[model samples]
Target chain A: MDFFFEGYLLSHGNVIGFIAGTLTTISFLPQVYYVYRSKKTTDISLSMYLLFFFGVLTWLVYGLILGSPPIIFFNAITLLLSGAVLLAKLIY
Target chain B: MDFFFEGYLLSHGNVIGFIAGTLTTISFLPQVYYVYRSKKTTDISLSMYLLFFFGVLTWLVYGLILGSPPIIFFNAITLLLSGAVLLAKLIY
Candidate 1:
């Protein structure tokens, strides 16, 4: 019974993690779109995005080490999206 | 031997995760500083921060469910920082 309960909790935990990843990953979309449309990133911090880019990159490596496809996939998309924002901060 | 190697990899994975978490969490500092200093968030996306705020909040709850202090601690800080950004976006 205890094992069954643990498995149940673990499964739900994975579900929540999935949702959390999806939400946070896609959250960058609005910022990217806003920056692209406005062509303004003066208010955005270059250092923040730069650091975040590296952080996401590190997460990518972590995912590879863990052999977790979901982590790899989400972080990959996040890297691209955040990279776009970082580029906007640089160019615009 | 296999179990020992698995443990080693898992330990290293935890270390990497710690670093990744620290990096991503602190990355918000520059943006917060920039917004506070510039008093301009016109280019910062309201939707993005709004979504991110909730995402972090969910992570906090997820951490609690998982009974993981590191997850809770990091997400809590992220919640505060992202919340500040969201508030700034709304106010300025």
Candidate 2:
């Protein structure tokens, strides 16, 4: 019974973790698409995003050092997408 | 030798984790302040933050279940701040 309960918890944890990571990473897509379509970012707070971009970079490093796959993967994608938005804000 | 090395690694890990968690959570402040000042979210990506807000919610739950202070603390603050931004977006 204890073994079964442990297995259930582990599986549940993995599923929830995966979903949380995936949602957080992909959530940046709409902003990317919106900025792409609008060609304007006048209202976006540059400071907040610049800090967030760097924060994500640190997270990526932290994940690598800790050998956490979910953390690494999510931060990698988030960095790319957030980086793109930052670039778009810069360019147009 | 092993004990010294382990202590260094553990302390280093804690410091970096604290920095990362703190920066990520606090980085949202500027955006919050900006929105408060401008009363505008015309360029803010609603869908993106909406998903992100929920993702942070899931993260909070995951953190609680896993007994991770950094995750729980960061996400809790993030949710409140992000939630405020969302509410502001709705109100104004």
Candidate 3:
């Protein structure tokens, strides 16, 4: 089972990772949209999201240094998504 | 500069990574609390968070298989935080 899973991930890992990362990262869309629609970020914490955004940036650098494709790829998407949410929170 | 950056990451990478990862992962707390307090996840997308949650799980597995400490640690924390948000979204 492990072997099969590994093989599946290895062959399709990049594609899956990309899709998953894209979808998950963009998941913030609904929240951002609602926040925009409502013009409220009352519940969102600025400091936390800022820190998290920076952390994601650092991780992206880490991935670049380590030459890890998935890390780099996922972090890139996550950064964008997280950043968008943070921006929306700040704006609204 | 690059060397210094690499060395910094090498020496304090794990620690910084942990802190960043923890902070970022837990940043969801405010959102969750807000959603809970307001009793609304109207802006939140269940499918997106669910998929992202699963994606995080898969990445955790990928990190484990790759034996990457940062990946493992960060993903572990992220899983918990994202999971919490997902649960809160579902419950409230």
Candidate 4:
């Protein structure tokens, strides 16, 4: 808790959870960045993104139910990140 | 219990976990297939796949520690799938 005294407060477990969750959640960014940079998405699969977004959405719900801030926060961000990729796959 | 009596056995919670896990794990296949089909990997990020593989590996270890069948099963598959993608990104 003191680690957050400067600004934020999170349990050690939550901090660990956030670390793991951040790693997984942000992993999607590179793909999105690739697409954004290349402007080519035909090689990417729409079905994959669709299924992935669905799964992430479910995780967000599960996190809410579980009252896990790390899970909820990371999944929410992932949802948006995945949604952007899915949109790119559609638009480009 | 009855669900598995015919051939397999898994609790309802496990069943649900498996369903969600399957959706996320199998989602990696499409990208792998795309890379396999197109053989174009310049746009994809090596860092992203590297990070992803690491994250999945952690999940796998966590699953093994928890003795959660669905987590173990899915993370193992995801490791392979993500590994395949990472390999493809490297190879092609």
Candidate 5:
């Protein structure tokens, strides 16, 4: 879509930002999957996820205030993925 | 110092950003401490840290390009802390 390119694919900086965002965002998936399959979280730190969730949440709000789709999109995904890990840590 | 306030404490948004950055950056400390104390990393996902480290590195580069101190500062701390965890995961 034109909007996609304009939002995240236009400039080289934006492209680099997109890649950086994608790497960090998707990075959480393996952790989520790992915890889901193993159902073990003894080694995970509760405070880490707690702080991360809140931090990501704040970043989401920051994204909202800035009206940056990339920030909002990436942070939202990060929040969900990190939240999954946090939830797994709580449950298991 | 005037520079400190000007850099991170001037705008309300900047203050919020600083807090968010602090929360996420320091979040890794507990994990590092946990792994250090227990010397266990069975539950931690290797791919997650691998991706995260690179992602944070890219973010650091992005920060350098933007010449944003907050971005650079926060990401540098995150890189170190996450790297510590990744290192521990590799070792133990």
Candidate 6:
């Protein structure tokens, strides 16, 4: 039953989650681009991104433990986005 | 079994998820404060938060339908955070 449910979700939940996750992940791009273009991150908080990165990292681990690809994949992308924001905050 | 699992999770996952969720949610506060403090959202993207909000809203709905408290709770808080960011982008 567990295996069956996992397989079912892999085909359905994984696809749906990925689609939703991709949209959510790309949504941060504009902010990243804005900061990159402007070279100003004063209004952005460094701690926020730093903390967010860790939180997403934890979620990634959680997803992995649960064998949930969507959670893992989404968090990985989110980690990158948050990491970029943190880097921009530092550089700009 | 489902009820037991839900109850078990309500005591465990809910608490952990809420802790993680609160941390993630508050992480956005700093950004919000910075935006409010500077009143300069020139670097912030309205579309990012708008899209994020909808993505999270979808997640919230997904969680509710699945009867997953963690997803619903975290997304709810996230919705507020992202909403604030969008509002700040518009106002500032």
Instruction: Report the number of the highest-DockQ candidate.
Output: 2
lDDT per prediction?
0.87, 0.83, 0.71, 0.74, 0.89, 0.74
Model 5 over residues A1-92: C-alpha lDDT tens digits?
24545444334776788889999999999999999999999999999999999999988867765668998999999999999999999999
lDDT of 6 by residue, B1-92 (tens): 25546555444643444555667777888877788788887777788888888888777756754667777777888888878888988886
Instruction: Give per-residue CA lDDT, model 2, range B1-92, as digits (tens).
Output: 25646556555776766777777788789889989899998888888888989999989878866878889999999999888777777777
On residues B1-92, what C-alpha lDDT tens digit does candidate 3 reach at each position?
A: 27647776766655755665666677776766666678776556677578778878877776666667876787787788778778877887
The ten-residue window of minimal lDDT in model 3 chain B covers B13-22
Model 2 C-alpha lDDT per residue in residues A15-79, reported as the tens digit of each score: 87888888888989999999999998977888878888988888876786677888889999999
- Clashing residue pairs in candidate 5 are none
Candidate 2 residue-wise lDDT at B3: 60
Q: Count clashing pairs, candidate 3.
A: 0
lDDT of 1 by residue, A1-92 (tens): 25546666566987887788888999999999988998988888899998899999988878877889987998999999999999998898
Residue B79 accuracy (lDDT) in model 6: 87
TM-score of 6: 0.78
Q: Name model 2 segments beyond 4 Å from true.
A: A1-11, B1-11
Interface RMSD measured for model 2: 1.6
Query: What's the lDDT for candidate 5?
Result: 0.89
Q: Per-residue lDDT of A1-69 in model 4, one digit per residue for the tens?
A: 134342332223345444556777889888888888888887677888999888888776566555667
The regions of model 5 sitting more than 4 angstroms off are: A1-11, B1-11
Return model 6's CA RMSD, one decimal. 7.9
Superior candidate under TM-score, 1 versus 3: 1
Lowest-sum lDDT 10-residue window in model 5 chain B: B1-10
Residue A77 in candidate 6, Cα distance off native in Å: 1.2
Candidate 4 TM-score, C-alpha based: 0.77
RMSD of 1: 4.9
Q: Write the per-residue lDDT of candidate 4 for residues B1-92, one digit (tens) a residue.
A: 13424233222334544556778888888888888888987767788889888887767655554556776788888899889888998887
The better candidate by TM-score, 3 or 6, is 6
- When 2 and 3 are scored with TM-score, the better candidate is 2
Question: Candidate 2 vs candidate 6: which has greater lDDT?
Answer: 2
Span of 10 residues, lowest total lDDT, candidate 4 chain B? B1-10
